[model samples]
Target: MDAQQWRIDVDREVCAGTGLCVGTAAGRLRLDAGRARPVREVVEPDQAVVDAAETCPMEAITVRSLTTGEVLAPEL
Candidate 1:
């Protein structure tokens, strides 16, 4: 994985299964079993993923910078 790759996580407990993330980034996220999950945990930097995180109604999605461990989405 590249140092600048993005890491995606979804808090199942906090997720409302609204599928907003999936709609925002279908290739990067999915709604499954009443929760959202990343299609892949680590992926190349993608704006769609960030949008997905930001669009999540429950704020269940989190995107991070793999190398710096910085929270990249949901704006804190």
Candidate 2:
């Protein structure tokens, strides 16, 4: 297994499940029954993940740098 490089959180209640994040970061995000969730609780810090968070219509996805505790997407 690999160490988690980033922390990705999806607010299911806030997620509209429009698939914007999933579409942008298919490998990181998935939609189940119109509820959006991370493929896993943690993932390698990737640009696609950031893009997914940025493109979320509801701003429900949050990506943070595990090392720096910095919010990478949605620009806060």
Q: Which stretches of candidate 2 lie over 4 Å from their true place?
A: 1-4
9-65 per-residue lDDT for model 1 (tens digits): 999999999888888897899888989899999999899999988888889989999
The local lDDT score (0 to 100) that residue 5 gets in candidate 2 is: 88
Instruction: Quote the positional error of residue 40 for candidate 2 in Å.
Output: 1.3
Clashing pairs in 2: none
Worst 10 residues of 2 by lDDT: 1-10
* TM-score for candidate 1, residues paired by index: 0.94
Q: Which regions of candidate 1 fall more than 4 Å away from where they truly are?
A: none
Instruction: Write model 2 residue lDDT over 1-76, tens digit each, in one string.
Output: 4445898999899998798888788778888988999988678868998888888888998888777778878787
Candidate number achieving the greatest lDDT relative to the actual structure? 1
**Separate clash counts for every candidate:** 0, 0
lDDT of 1 at 26: 78
